[model samples]
Structure formats: structure tokens, C-alpha cells
Target: MKYLLVREDEDGVEQLWGRCAGVDGLFVDPVPLPREVLTLRGCGPDGILGDVLAGPDVSLRSLGDLCVEVWDDEQPVQWWTLVDAVVVAHQPHAADPALYDIVLGAGVRKDESFVELSAPSRFELSGGTTAAAARPSRCSAVDGLFESRDDPAPVPMELIGCEAVEPLLVGTQQPRRWARDWAELLVLDRHGGVMASRVVGLAIDGARPSVLGDGLEDITLTDGGDGRPSPAVRPVWEKWCQGPPSEPNVWAAYDAQGRAEWLELSTRAWRVPAPRPDRSGGEYHVDGRFVTDVPGLHCAIAEALLGPGRYFGREWNAFEDCLAGGFGVIPPFTLIWHDSEVARRALEDGAKDAGERLPYFEGVVRLLERRGVTVLLR
Candidate 1:
């Protein structure tokens, strides 16, 4: 199995980044998104005030990617990526379960998504930097930067096989690198076709090559898995990484975070543009046999809506977004949920809404129904 690192040229042409000689942590479970703290100095009980923190919005109310929204009156001035916060008991001033003196830490500043804006005097902390998202960008980066480095300073990638793509190779760099830090790694077919892409963040460490016959040295193939499905989910990607799968439904082989990782890969692999508004009233089927957890339900739905390696939604908020329009199906569509009992038994009223508990399967049905989707359970 040969692994080639690639990126797009200025004209969107596939440029060879490198022929991978070795990879370190490529096949791993998705890592837990690192958590960051958001501190709101006591503004004397304002609206929606508290140490609201959690990484990646796993709920319906999440603004964008589980980011905590910074408000300017009725409107959301900015949406900052947030995670759960730890208590600071060491600081006597940082008493009160919800209070902290720390202001504008590394997490918020490093975020390029939001620009630093003056928080209308009151919103700014002592450092006078407020993390605010003007309008939550509803976009995902394919290759982190996804753009070519204009005068990139020997981006941290190194690989062999330069003889094949001499034209695409940049000036004078030996053992060329084909991708940026957040570059997407694709599994190519024997005939050099795009099979799977965009699930892995291939970071080049640029180390001295050793016994790596085909090993692309100095590259870490994940977000280090933090708490997400890093190594555990490697099995799901191993075969696909080697070559394109013989068929679909291959993602159903794993469960828990592994299944979720499969869905993530599928969402990228079988991705397609949503049909126009007039293309409504189509009938889709959900393979509910493996509907064991929240991620399982997503796998079933994505396969149902788009095909085998396709996607509709991965979470509640994303599901609702798909229901609105443009995730392969329009409103007034039909959803034939096959093997309904599997999900009904496995799913509990587990999803929380302030206080109300709703079963995920039922929630999906209700949301679909409300969106004019006639869900026919079988």
C-alpha cells in the first residue's frame, strides 16, 4: 500500500506533497477537542452570565461547534470555541462556583475564527481583550489552511518520491513536503483516484529517516487523540487507508467513538452537493440495526440519506440543520426507518433540553416530522 501526501495548486489542481514513507499516529481514534476556560468578570448579574464551558457543542442549543456565544445585547456579537472550565480554588478571589479572575487566556487568543474586538467597554476584561465572533462562520476547513503557502518557510513536512511530480515540487527543498499542518490525507486507489479524504490532520515533524522503508518519517497523523477516538478508532481506518473499500457499510464494523469516526470519514468521502429546493419529496431509508448509541444513529442516518459513505448529520444541532434544507434531502420528504425496534430499545430519553428528556430516536422522528418529513417506522 502506497501513501501519497497531496494538496491543491493555485488553480485547484492536485499537487503531490510527498510519497509517505512512514506515519506515526495516523490510525487512531478521534481525540477529545481540548478544553479552554472562558471567564466573565462579575458584571453584576447580566443576562446569560456563568462560567459556560464545554468543547464542541454536542447539543441542539450549541451556537457553532459547541462554542460559547458572546452576546452584544440581543444579538450574538461573537461565538467563541469553548470547553468545560476547571475551578481555581488557589486564588482566594476566585471563590464562588462560577467565578474566576483569570482573563483572556491562550485558548481564546489563538483562535483565528474570532477577531479581537473592544467589548463595548463593559465586555472587556482588565487586559481589555474580548473574544467575540462577528458571525459564527458555518464553514469547515478541508486541509486546515486548505490554501497554498505563498512563501511558506519549509512547512514541517518531508517525504521522498519527488521524481514523479517534478513540476509540482517547489524550489530547492529536498525530500519535499506535500501538505500543510492541518492538511487532509487521502487514501488513493491503485489507479491514483481519490478514495477517502479530510478526516486526518497530517502534521509533519521533519525527523531523520531510519528503518522506515515506506514510513513517512516525522509525521503525526491525528490531533493526538486527546480524549477523542485516537488509537482505538485506527482499526476502522486501517483497511481504507491501505486502499479503497470493496463496498459500502464498511463503517458499521465499529462502535462508540470508532463508529463516530467512521461517520466523520464518510461525511467527507461520500460528500455531495445538496439537491435544489424543487428536489423534495424523495424517500430515504435508515438502517437501524446498529442504532446502539448517538453516533450509531448518525451512521444509520448518513448512510440512509446519502448512500453508504454519505452523510446527513452527525449530531442533534447538525441533524436539525440538515432537516432545514440542503443535506441531500429537502423538506416534505419521506423517511422509512427500517428495523425501528433496534433504536427504540437502545435509545433512552437521554438527550436533555434544560429539564425535558427526549429519546434520541424519537427526537429524530419528531424533528423530521416537524420538518415535513413523513417518518414511516418499520
Candidate 2:
């Protein structure tokens, strides 16, 4: 069958809405969420911007990991506005992650790119090193900020909100609250009579009872027969359509959109794992076999900690949230990433988040350590 669409009844139970041939956006990558760019007019940082002086030629610099603290009147606490490293107008060294624009004068939005700068600290960098020092292609590099010219003795720099920092995605993808004629079918679990659910995009049109979800012809509806997923993953889905395997790690063979569908189905099916066995701490092993891409990494991790087919997180934020207790295990636990050389060889390249890129495997390990998880990479 192309898909078996199911919906909840009046009693909050999902029932079969008949099978469907296909719909749109089912296997598509999620759209990036709109960026939340806050325009801070009067800005000031406590000793963060070491010695950046006001100048005509805008300085090009990089700040590694910055915790931009904003005061919240309602909450009366400092809010974290953290962004990755950057360069003003150019891509900085991978070591120097971000570049925040800092104008000398205090003003308002000149246009979409430039923001009003009052008084603020300017810092951008990556890998805890200045871009110029490592690369030396631009001006002489220092740790935090940099300038190309040797002007004069620095004055008391008047700072403003220079719109140099790249806005990160509010969420991984903007919430598509509504679905089109076709939606993804998620099988939550095998227990409880195979609990199932789907996005609310599917609806019956006119009186065509046979034509479900934009009408699936024999061609598109035929999984593995025709190559909707090309050939590499066709065999994988062909097996999946039969019924999700009771065993785990079915995600070993998928990537791109196909990888996404695997996560959706595996997330629901893998919830059968037992709760955190030890409240104090425990050992979780991440099998590195399928840990090639980002989604594959999540699949391996989820299966490692939660159990086969379980979902710890599809992305960094979700994984971070799961570390705050609940889910399955608590932090301060041991996470032995076995055969990690697989990830080392495979994930040497950077992984893109929002619009920025950072080291994939290292980022994951750093995150675990930051959350109090002991990572023993083998």
C-alpha cells in the first residue's frame, strides 16, 4: 500500500482513514524557520570587547562562542542570545566561527543589513582563536576582534548594535501547522494495537472514495517498484513498507529525506524501551556502525541509550532537552561511543545548523560533556 492514513476518533483514538497513494512534502526536508533578529539599539558588554576602537573602515573580526546576555524586565534575569562565530562580510576561518558588525556611531536601521548602533561590545571568532592569526590573509589577527588598518591610539569607542551576527533559525524548521493533501504517516508504537497518527493535511475531496490523498496512481504508489527514492534507498523502503521490523537499527540504509522518514517511524516504534534503569547513573553505548550522517548519528545514539528504534533526538536541541533528565537516562552517566572511528572518519566535515556550519561529531561530544555526560569515544 502507498500509505495507510489514520486519524483519531471522537474518543481521541486514531482509526484508519483508508490507504492513500501519495501526497506532497511527505519526504521533503523541513523548511528552515524564519530568523529572529533582535535589533539592540543601546548595547554594552562588561569587558568582553577587549580594545576595539571606533573607525571609519568597519573592522572585520570574529567571536567564537558568545553568550549575549539581555536583561528581561518581566523575568528580571539575563536572557542568553548566543550565536555561532562569524566574520563581518566574509567567511572567517573555520576556527573563527562568527563575525558581529559593530558600527562606531549610535543610530537606527539604515537599511535591512545595518542596524542602529548605540554602545555595544563587538566580538566574533571561532575555535577559540582569531581568524587573522591562523589564516593571516586579512589584517593581523588577534583573539576576539580585528581591524585591517593601523590607525591611532584607540578612543573611548562609541558602540551601537551592528547587525553583523547571523540570525539563527527560531526552530530547525518553521512550523508548518497545516499540511497539504499529503502528510506523513507515523506509526507510534507496536504495542497498544499499533498506535498510529498522521498530520492533519489529508482530507476527502468531493465523492471520490477511491481517490485518497490526491489519488495515488499505480506508478507513484508502488514502493520499491518505481524509484521515488532513487535506487540506493529503494530497497530500504521496500522492506519498511511491509511493516516496520520488530528489531532495531532499520535506519542503517537511509539518508536525506529517506532518513527523515526513518526517524519519524522509528521515533514512535522505539518508545517501547524501558525507563532509565539507574537513577544515579548508567552506561550507554552508541554503536558507531550507522553513525555516518547527522540523522544516522541520532539513530545510533537513540538505540544506544533508549534502546533499538528509540529516538533520543533528531537534532542537537532535541538531544540537549533530553539530557535535562526524563526521556531515558540522566547525565553524569557514561556514554561509551564505541567504534567512534567510524564517526571520526565520516563526520570530519561540518554539519550545518540553521545557516551556519560547525563540526558535526565534535559538536555532539562537546554537547554531551557540557550536559555532564561522560563521553568515552573508542
Identify the leading candidate in terms of lDDT. Answer: 1
Error (Å) of candidate 1 at residue 246 is: 6.6
**Compared with the true structure, what per-residue lDDT tens digits does model 1 show for residues 1-378?**
345656666798877655554444444343234434333343221111121222232122222233444444344454433333233221112335433232222223222324344442233211100111211212111111111223212212233322223432332233245333443455554555555553344443333433553432343332322222366777876655655444656766787678777766656554433344445777888877778877888878877776666667777666677767666677787889989988887876344221123466776777678779899999
In candidate 2, what are the lDDT values of residues 305-367, reduced to their tens digit?
866556676766667677787676768889999889888778764342211223568767877
Q: What is residue 53's positional error in candidate 1, in angstroms? A: 14
lDDT of 1 at 4: 62
**Best by TM-score, which number?**
1
Which ten residues in a row are the worst by lDDT in model 2?
163-172
Off by over 4 Å in 2: 1-196, 201-204, 209-238, 241-244, 270-280, 352-358
Each candidate's clash count: 24, 25
lDDT value, residue 63 of candidate 1: 23
Off by over 4 Å in 1: 8-14, 27-66, 71-79, 84-110, 118-184, 189-191, 196-229, 242-249, 272-284, 353-357
What is candidate 2's CA lDDT for residue 190? 23
For each candidate in turn, give its C-alpha RMSD to the true structure in angstroms: 9.5, 16.1
